[model samples]
Target: MKLYYTPKSHFARKNRILIDALSLEVELVDAGNVADSTPEIFANNPLMKVPTLVDGHQVIYESDHIAAYLVRKFDPTDSYQVLTNDVNQLNLRAVMNGVMTAEVELIMAERSGINTQHLKRFDKLRATVTQGMNWLENQADLFPQQPSYAGFHLICLWDHLLLYQMFQLKHPHLQQHIEKLSGFDCVVKSTPL
Candidate 1:
């Protein structure tokens, strides 16, 4: 089995954390990205993204899909995955997805050094991310009692916060939410950041 990914990518971090926690051993290979329009990227996935996996004639793309597939295959005995039979875990996945996108958008925007024409949109995105973070912090109880899919999602978001951290300064507010999530040991171990 071969896991093709770049260590520097956030999505790749998700896959890597899962790999670490599940203790799945696979041959590591760096497929880089589709920037130069690599043939393997197009051949494997039209998206030309990192973190693609080659497993037994199966080609997997996207970090979330790859993580789930690897867990299902390598850690089948573990029923406490993020997307499992549990309804709460599924709901957590949904919540996390929203937060994850907000984080990604904010990070990408910040990295560009300017919001430019998208000022209103950037402000809106920042507000939405803050709102989501506030809400999650307020309702920490909604997370499952056990480490599961939602747990992974929260941890993944935390990882993104540290990695991208679009907040330049005066962003101590998000830290409260992050601190709340960090209370979990699983979050510490699973988070790549």
Candidate 2:
């Protein structure tokens, strides 16, 4: 199996961490996203996105789906049950994903200098992230005791936000939670370079 990804992409980092945690041997193809559409990536993923997995004839994209596949296929411990069986963690994961999407959009808009007309939207997006962080802070106790898929996504979310300096969320509890998550080996090994 091979994964087409960029080393710095948090989405790709999620998969890389999972692969390492599972101790699965897979080739990491450094397919940088330099163009609007790279023909090589488009051939495998119509979306021309990173973290595209090629497992024989099967092609998988999207970080969450790829994580699920890894859990079902590679994890003998079934640790993914912590993410799938818990309702609160699932909702927390969804919030993390929402923040991630909004942060990416904000980053793209700022990078492209398209900030004039969408100023309010950008502010709203920032506010949305803050709200999500607040929610996570309040519900930190409900987090899984072990490093599961949801915990991985949460760590990725916090790292991505900090990496781009997009927005700072000032919640001490969440910060502690993040620190705790970062202590995991998968997270330590998956830090974006």
Candidate 3:
């Protein structure tokens, strides 16, 4: 199995952490700048997205799907429950993904030399991130104290936010939740520098 990822992508970070947590023997391939659409990434994923997984003849794109496939295949016992059946955690995970998408869009736009503040679409994106984060903050107590898949997703999102300085909202509960789980080896190893 081979996992193609970008170093700075939070989505890739989630799967990287999962790979270590599950102790899977998969090759990690750094797919240079995603924006450049390297042939290595494009060949595996038509969309040229990060966190693309290749297992034998099967190719999987999208971080969530790759995580699910890995958990289902490598972990027959489902010990980590990476694909959680819990509805609340599933919903929280979706919201975290949304926030991540919105923030990534904003960062990409800024990097493209676009004045995001002047665009209505960018405004909506900012609102999506802020509102989603606020919701997550309110539901912080619902998150597991241990390093589950949903917890890892939330940690990745929070770390990305900090990495980009995207928002300044107060999320003390979420912060504490993340801090509690930060000592885990998988998380420490996969954290972006």
Candidate 4:
């Protein structure tokens, strides 16, 4: 098995979280250094994506998809272990996904420090991020119940957000969000990307 990954990517980190949690073994290949023009990833995924997993003849792409696949393939009992099986799971996953992408864009913009070209994109993403956070705040009940794929990804995203300092997330709702995650401390603390 092979995993195409980039060290600094939250998406890649998500997969690593699952791999570690399930004690899965796979070869990790650096595949996102576009400066070197990684046509192999584009060829494998057709979209030039990272965190693509190749399990023998099967090629699984997308970080979330790969995470689910890993859990199912390696640890069938993993579903309720890190995530809940609620109907609202996808919505929670959406919130986490939004935060992850927003954090990624924000961090990249800060590091690049570009002018009109990059700042404009940052402005748009920032607005979208606020909307996503509002949604998550409104759906705060999504956590604290049971574990689900959404919950797992949400914690993964939250950890990455904290690690990268995406925003001064010490806001009230942010603290509430952390409190909501108290139930899954075992899985969250156990998995290290």
Candidate 5:
């Protein structure tokens, strides 16, 4: 299996954390800036996205979907369920996904030199991320104590926000959660890329 990913991609980082936790070995290809698609990667995923995986003849894209595939194909002990099986956590994961999507959309717009300086859509995206953070803070008790799938998603979002200085996340509980998650071995190994 070969996985195309950029070093700094938060979504790709989530998969890396899971892959390490499961002790899976697969080729990691550094596909630079996903938007600037290379011919090989573009051939594999027409959408030209990173975290695209080629397993046998199967092509996979999207971080969460690729994560599920990795767990099913490589993790014989079904350890992936530790990350995917909780319904309540899944709801938070959905919210994180939405926030990440909106944040990336705004980022893409900015990168494209679009007029996002005062755009309502850009502000809305920022607000959405804030709301998600607030929700995560309120549901701190619902979060699993261990590093689950939703935990990984939350950490990835938090890490992205920290790395890019995107937003001011003032949720104490969520902030504490991220600090705790950051100390995990899987997360440590996946850092500095």
Candidate 6:
């Protein structure tokens, strides 16, 4: 199996952590800078997105779908509960994805020479991120005590936020959770370059 990813993408980082945590023997292919059109990613994914997985004749795109596929294929019993059946975990995952989407949009806009602070859509995007963060803070107890799928997503998002300096997250509970898992080998090995 081959997983196409960019080192700095929070989306790709989620899968990388999962692969490492499960000790899956998958080839990691850097898709180059996603900011530009990359033929390699485009060949496997029509959308040209990172976190695309190629297993034999099957091609998978989208980070969440790829994660589900990985868990089902490599860890069918989901011993790690990386892809849980719990509603709270599923909802948390959706919220995290929303925040990630908003961040990516704001980043792309800023890179295109647009002053995001002056645009209404950008304002909405910022609001989405803030709302997501607020929701996560309120449901802090739902966070897993161990490193699971939702926990990995939160860690990846937190790292991305720090990397881009896009938002100042002051939630103590979330901070504590991240700090506790910071030393996990899966996280340590997958730290973005």
- As for TM-score, the candidate ahead, 2 or 5, is 5
Superposition TM-score, candidate 5 onto the true structure: 0.90
| Better structure of 2 and 3 per TM-score | 3
lDDT of each: 0.63, 0.77, 0.87, 0.65, 0.79, 0.88
| Candidate 1 per-residue lDDT over residues 1-193, each given as its tens digit | 7877655455665666667666667776767542546757433677776778888899998777887788777776765563466665465555556766666666655666765345887677777667676666656666655555555556666666667656432234434445665655545654553
TM-scores for candidates 1 onward, in order: 0.70, 0.89, 0.95, 0.72, 0.90, 0.95
Over 51-144, each residue of candidate 5 has an lDDT whose tens digit, in order, gives: 8888888988889898888877777565645335567768887888888888888788878889776678888888888898888889987776
For lDDT, the strongest prediction is: 6
> Cα RMSDs of all predictions?
4.3, 2.1, 1.3, 4.0, 1.9, 1.3
Error of 5 at 50 (Å): 1.5
Cα lDDT of candidate 6 equals 0.88
Question: 147 in model 4: Cα distance from truth in Å?
Answer: 5.0
Regions of model 4 farther than 4 Å from truth: 32-36, 41-43, 81-87, 109-113, 116-121, 144-148, 171-193
Q: Given candidate 4, what's the lDDT at residue 162? A: 65
lDDT for model 3: 0.87
Model 3 clash pairs are: none
Off by over 4 Å in 1: 31-43, 85-87, 109-118, 168-193
1-193: candidate 2 lDDT, tens digit per residue: 9988877777888888888878889888888653457658633587777778888988888888888877778875776453375678778878888888788778777777786344788888888888888888898777766776766777788888888886776778767767877877778987976
How do the residues 1-193 of candidate 3 rate in per-residue lDDT, one tens digit apiece?
A: 9988878899989998889999988888888877775566544687878888889999989998999999888888766667778899888988999999999999998998999986899999999999999999999888987678888888899988988897995899998988887989989987888
Ranking by lDDT: 6, 3, 5, 2, 4, 1
Give candidate 6's TM-score.
0.95
Worst 10 residues of 5 by lDDT: 76-85
Model 3 shows how many backbone clashes?
A: 0
Q: In angstroms, give how far residue 148 of model 3 lies from its true place.
A: 0.4
